[model samples]
Target: MTMTDNPPAVADGFVVRRSIDIAAGIDRVWAAVTQPDLIAQWFGDRCRLDSLEVGAGGAFGWDDAGDFPFRIEEFDPPRAIAYRWSNAVAGALDPLQVVDAHSTLFRFTLEERPGGTRLTVVETGFESHERPDAVVEDHRQGWTSELDELVALVEGAA
Candidate 1:
């Protein structure tokens, strides 16, 4: 339940991270994240996940921003899931198009907290991005608003 407090040095390391406590159980939070239908309610307008299998492919789309392709890098049921996605490009991205070091990886880590669940989304690998500032700013602000919506959706359902 204890994560490192230090943010990685900014020289070459870039990260946009956010953690929020939701007044819901882990299962509820997990469903909101992993299930495509529920993901659409919070994260993106369209969630196209092939499946929940670890290596499955997926895409999150916004009418204005375009589709971003991603592959499941890690899947651990209701506990965690990590997605490696192509952040720089939009629309019609192939799952295999993401180069390991070039693309960004965002992980959702869930921990049971008293009377609720603590969900943390940490996105790294921004240093490889052509416009790291734009990427960070986009996600930094996105996560803030997205997480607020997540809390509203999940807690409201409870």
Candidate 2:
């Protein structure tokens, strides 16, 4: 797996964008991202989703990190999934009570390549947080490591 930081010129400085090519088809990669079971294998230790449709809500957490509430903003099967969540107050408050000021938007896009899938993840809105630089840097590292894990899981299965 190869990850690159490609923040769009139009985006605010707080954005963290990464793209990687995985040795798997779009369907397999999409399932790994949207399904609770497969998402847990790479994203978090566990995940719970109310629904997979746009406007649906859910929670995802790890043993070390408490759950965070998330609302789906966009859902396009095998292609894209966008959600809003409060990572600014991650383990400090009840995620269910998160407001727009405390949340960031995360988007995942998948494009079918000749031999595999190109997966891109972009997280924005860190400027709303108290510590934008820290938050953005933290997520940049987090995404890099997490995406590497995702690549390993999907490619290993292939």
Candidate 3:
């Protein structure tokens, strides 16, 4: 199939998106998110969630960086959590810094399917006039690795 024939319309650089049906209930998945220790184990290298309240905020980052610059844009408990994130490395090929707005959206949605929970992650709005392709691919690779890490941690393999 030609590029046009593909229905999903993959973006130019990298349309990096993936979802997995985790063999755990929504509650388990929710626990993995709201709990700071569990989140650090699964998703973040290190994380701090302020309040679980809908309007409350949180911060997270990899090992070296203490916390990523972000606030909870939306919080719906076990259903969904949408937050803003930024890497802030100007002119260094860092994808997360593409947006001049100082933040990009990272949304996680959980659905209860027949066997387990369907987890969906979306990190978008990385189109910058400076470095579009590099930014897109960087986040794509990062998210891919992140999802893999999440699966491993949830399945007790990591």
- Stretch of 10 with least lDDT, candidate 2: 3-12
- Order the candidate numbers by lDDT, best to worst: 2, 1, 3
Runs off by more than 4 Å, candidate 1 = 1-13, 92-102
Local accuracy of candidate 2 as per-residue lDDT tens digits, 50-142: 889988888878788788878899999989999888775556767675567888998999999988899889998898888888888878888
Question: Which pairs clash in model 1?
Answer: none
Residue 147 in model 3: shift from native, Å?
Answer: 1.3
What is the model-wide C-alpha lDDT for candidate 1?
Answer: 0.80
lDDT scores of the candidates, listed in order: 0.80, 0.82, 0.63
Best by TM-score: 2
For model 3, residues 10-38, the per-residue Cα lDDT tens digits are 24443445566676678887777677788
Candidate no. 2 TM-score: 0.89
User: What's the true lDDT of residue 54 in model 1?
Assistant: 81
Better of 1 and 2 by TM-score: 2
- Candidate 2: give its CA RMSD in angstroms: 3.4
TM-score of each: 0.86, 0.89, 0.75
Greater TM-score among 2 and 3 belongs to 2
